[model samples]
Target: MKKILVVCTSGLGTSLAMRLSIERFIRERNLKVKVEHADMGSANFIEADLIIGAKQVISCLSKQNDIETIGLEDIVRRRYIEEQLLNCDTIQTWLKEKEGLR
Candidate 1:
């Protein structure tokens, strides 16, 4: 399973909310990915296949080339998250692989 790390400035409420949203999205789509949350300080140290957070936070995470990152303008907007994630090449490829597994 792919790992997703949701980050926020404090590793508190905002990150938890984003993690919840991502978990819901994954569950609804039956995507095989593990989701977790962390603070900005811990993001770089975490081993996640994907790092998702606000644009500002994600920009910092993006510096590392190995992990995929998704920056959202609005952290709690489920529709926006779904739309952006659908447009992500990594997510699209994962979706295709998931479909093939079925």
Candidate 2:
């Protein structure tokens, strides 16, 4: 399955919120993927298809282009997750494959 990393300042409260939001989106869309959370300072590195986080967290992980990164204004909103991820190729392809089911 595809993997998504949701990052935040400390990867605790705020990041947890984002992870939950993304999880809901994944469930609602019936997408086959996994979502995870990490802290900007402690994430070290990530192994996933996409990384979603605030500007700060994204900046920290920007050096690694191997993993795609999406910046978010707010970490706990489905709208933000949808807006940022909709145009992503990973999401696009996944959605295309699942479109018939929906």
Residue 92 displacement (Å), model 2: 0.7
Residue 52, candidate 1: alpha-carbon lDDT: 86
User: Model 1 reaches what TM-score against the true structure?
Assistant: 0.92
List the pairs of residues colliding in candidate 1. Answer: none
Residue-level lDDT of model 1, residues 21-69, one tens digit each, is 8898899999889999999998888888878899998877637666778
Residues 1-102, model 2: lDDT tens digits: 799988888788877888888888889888889998888865657678888888767886656656667888766667977877887777887899888677
Model 1's alpha-carbon lDDT is 0.87
What TM-score against the true fold does each predicted structure earn? 0.92, 0.83
Clashing pairs in 2: none
Per-model C-alpha lDDT, please? 0.87, 0.80
Cα lDDT, model 2, residue 69: 79
Error of model 1, residue 73, in angstroms? 0.9
